[model samples]
Target: MAVDPRGADLARLISEDPGGPVVMLNLLRFAPDGAAAYQEYSRRAAEFLHKYGGRVLYGGQGSTALVAETGQAWDAVLVVWYPSRDAFSSMVADPGYLEITSLRTQALSEAVLQATVPWPGFGES
Candidate 1:
């Protein structure tokens, strides 16, 4: 039932940074009547995302999983790219951004926010 990141999580993200940009993978599960609330949160968050050099590469509703565990199917998925971990940290820490996070917190029953690094195939340069 973890909807948001904590100080320790952010610190670890920084310490573990291998450098360069990072893409965040978000797997969201909504509470009852939560989808509308989450959509509002996303709308309000757009400006901040723009301010911090981040963008949502994809956002879509999740459906019955063709292959997965019983509880593995999520309500939605979002893939966001940020210039760096620091940018993400700063954006989340922003006073304005913090004010509106309640919407997201109240909306999600659970979530998975992960930093994913691109795997460069050998000889791709």
Candidate 2:
């Protein structure tokens, strides 16, 4: 139930940079009455996200899964794109960003922060 990334995690993310923009997949499971707090955290963290060249491609509450096993349905999902993994790393390391991270920590019982790499030439016409 790790809700946040550690220093080593951040380092590995940068060291394993796959080049180009990185889209992050965030799967969140909230603690009891945690959704409101998480929303507040998102609001406060927007400035940092923009400053680091990160943007939310999509974000929404999870619904009944048409195809999935139990324990796989998330409470929320966020798809965010960053200019690069380095930008994400730097954003998480910022002192200001760090200050409000506790809000996220308190809000989620479990979370998955994953990076998604686009297929080579997949998006090209």
- Give the per-residue lDDT of model 1 (tens digit) for 5-100: 999999999999999999999999999999999999999999999999999999999987999989999999999999999999999999999999
Candidate 1 residue-pair clash tally: 0
RMSD of each: 1.8, 1.0
Residue 64, candidate 2: Cα error in Å is: 1.3
**Model number with the top lDDT:** 1
What lDDT is reached at residue 15 by model 2? 85
Cα error, candidate 1, residue 43 (Å): 0.5
Query: Given candidate 1, what's the lDDT at residue 31?
Result: 95
Whole-model alpha-carbon lDDT for candidate 2: 0.94
What's the TM-score of every candidate structure?
Answer: 0.95, 0.95
Worst 10 residues of 2 by lDDT: 9-18
